[model samples]
Target: METSGAPQTRGARLHHPELSTLVHTSRFHAGRQPGATAVICEDRRLTYADLHHRSNRFAHALTAAGLAEGDRVAYLGKESEHYYEALFACAKTGTVLVPVNWRLTAPEVAHILQDSGTRLLLLEDAFTPTVEGMATEPPETVVRLGSLATWSSRYDDTEPEFEATPDTPVAQLYTSGTTGLPKGVVLAHRTFFAIRDRMAAAGVDWIDWRAGDIALIGIPGFHVGGLWWATQNFNAGTTVVAMRAFAARQAVDLIRDLGITTACVVPAMLRMMLTEPGVGAEDFTTLRKIVYGGSPISEALLEESLTVVDCDFAQIYGLTETGNTAVCLPPAAHVPGSPLMQAAGRPYPGVRVKTIDARGRELPPGEVGEVCLHTPARMVEYWGLPDRTAETLVDGWIHTGDAGHLDEDGYLFLRDRIKDAILVAGENVYPAEIENTLESHPQVAEAVVVGAPDERWGEYVHAFVVPVSGPPPTARDLHAFLVPRLASFKLPARYELVDAVPRNPSGKILRRELRDRFWSGAARNVN
Candidate 1:
């Protein structure tokens, strides 16, 4: 209904259809282009027709198992053809898909399931032990990937009856919480379609898509990078080649062997790919476009990737709440001398971005402030947190809690998080959890964790600790103790023994002072 841009308007429609619109699109494309490949998983290949039929079967199976339209289904598995089928099946049945991060601990997985009120879970057999040991029993329907035959037989007799409306919830993505626990961000079909349409209008060209075009998706499907890119390409009738897990050599091999033309990866992943042995010119010849995001890519890494991949590189910026990419630095802007490359690029079509001060007053161009957004692509709300939702969304703008400035040229430059959260390797590391864990140590009196610039990862977690009774625990000791308590990525990388943490008169840790050390020579405060 909203018409903010041209290409978006062409894709937009007045009717609110069900989430199954994706399935319908797949079927329509298949019927029109039956021979077109829709997915490629290692040795397996599936046409659009194959995907449609399989997803229908999967949807029917889900319905017969007593799963209804509003039920939450958690997917805890790696990227594969099956993952796509499950996602489309959920969309077809109007069930919400909640993809669990494979890196999380058993407890973290259980927490997500319970928090999201998931009734059914679809998992790969490899993770059977992990799921079986969870504290709470998810819904009785636990379908393992390898045993689909047994599960599918249980529901084959039931008739397929599924209809999804545009208002139906499509996904509930959980974000790393800064205060307490992670919160599920509820997103509807309209939000997804709006973002997809906006992205297509801004730069994506589906016409370039062809039967032979192969997309290598190296990032985990649990993350937005892999999930959205795969979906968009699949809808366009392109073959998507997924890697179960990210390995630099494996990715290069896929490009060389599979003739993959496009791929999505983070800067860290790109760095690792360049470091792989035998990584050379020919390994990258098949690649035409390499999309990198999730964190700022240093000029050095960007240049290195250009040399290794021989492809146009594009940068995207957004969070889970913004429906993947709200701002994109197009591939043409990757010119070595282009000043725009230093910015996060312009806002995606139909996405309006503005900088606002603490009082919510709009700031003039080039002035740093909280970055807020107005877009139909924005999440409906943070699930079960009305007060938090109100705090974030006001007057149709979603306060990003990110500090940035928009230049006169309309390029966005990020400074820091308005909420003072830390980003390490593109993963959010909240200081509250680290400080709480450190303070729990009997030998420590007080603790503060902050982000420090690192060449490898965008930032690394640094902890400042004050001894209580005996000598403060060593860095190794603290890391060992925290590894089991928190996600590995959330653990502090460096430990600084200090008499006291720098704090304000009101007793708030001065994270700015800690950040200054690493960013002293950088043009921007952000690493």
Candidate 2:
């Protein structure tokens, strides 16, 4: 959870105070509070001074390896002190840090590596097999994270001379590829500071991180929520206690034992913790506020959570392209039976949101249209995908594929996702990616994927397949085919043999129609 970097005037300051760029963020806090603990991971604790020196040495190590400004460095591991080190080190040296999700299969992992054109790959020892199995050429400077300590110790503890600007790409977070292949969302140093600075200027006390704030980092670092949330905790001079892997019981224990004052988690994690045995209101007495996003929380889960927890609940809505959260549902808005709880909340101080029709004209309130937004924290561009960048970011407004309507009071109510995506436990699962694997089977002719109503997970992957003019393929046969190509979570939870897949005139699969057939009599479009 520790982030930020060395003493280096490597950039010009933006509008934000003191620390405008990522490089300055480190020097400002470390100089002010050197002895303060920055991170807590199991038995390891890193102070601000340690964070500065270790990141300084790591910056030199990366420089010695010939990774200069704008070079891409990728990390394939879970959340760790090492992950944050690489993030800040890259921030200081002006290199782009790409954290790939370790949950991806060899092929999906290979695509990100090849697409990003990574120069240095910082990998965990456990992921060696995945990297080795990839057909693509691996990055030249591959350093196993298990030995990262020994590697960085050889370098100098001083900062380098590479100048990074406020607009310099600090990180490239890959979206889950809801539309097609995932595009790298390029975030600058200024992207991290924008929202906080705006909130301070406007005197919005929605998510102020106090000095004594101890944040529990629960989400995976590969996602924007995890990485950006940790960095913000550091920027505010708060300590971050990160969990390597999320378990319901352990999370409750960490809050009880470690006194986690603030936490950023998805709705799924909260749902599990509410049902975890022995968890009660007393366990979370120290928690002041929790910022949750990625998916809308069910009313049932919210009611159960509030029953056992007496803390401020803030709901956030954003994508990887937006840096983190652009809109937030403040604690006061979470009433038990109100329309506000169903809405995605209002925008931050400097962020502006508007719904637009296909013609790009702004739609009036209550009219369902595409959610478009403009914020200081918007991504620079989709890396190497100029066409996609143009399509998504038009005239500085990002067209979020989500179909939602803004109320008179400006709360965004999400109706449906325009993109063919399945929100499975807060993870985006594109049917195209799954269909590609299912159709690869010899016994399958055509395939269509959709999300079905799920109890534990919000929506689980379900596939409909048309068989080749022979015996119908068994679920086991299709499962075996996808085992190697897809990750365990991406695998279809249910399969239905169909005569033919439903498609429109232009050969586009009508996934919503297919979903409706199975989701009949359901209270809502559950996904």
Which prediction has the highest lDDT against the true structure? 2
Give the clash count for each candidate: 4, 0
Candidate 2 regions exceeding 4 Å error are 1-16, 420-527
How many residue-pair clashes does candidate 2 contain? 0
TM-score of each: 0.76, 0.79
Candidate 2 TM-score to native: 0.79
lDDT of 1 by residue, 97-148 (tens): 9988776667778888988888888888777777778887766778888776
lDDT of 2 by residue, 1-527 (tens): 11233332312121225667768867777787799899888889999888888999999999889988899999998778888788889988999999998877788889999999999999998999999999887888899999998999998877677667879999998887633677899999878889988887787767767657889988878888888788888887778898887888989999989889899988769967876777789989999889998765655567667777899998889888888889998999988878687788899999999999889889999987789989899999999989999999988888889888899999988765666667888876766567756765768767778888888898998899989778989999898888997888889998999987665321235677898886898877765
Error of 2 at 421 (Å): 11
C-alpha RMSD between model 1 and the true structure: 11.5
Residue 132, model 2, lDDT: 92
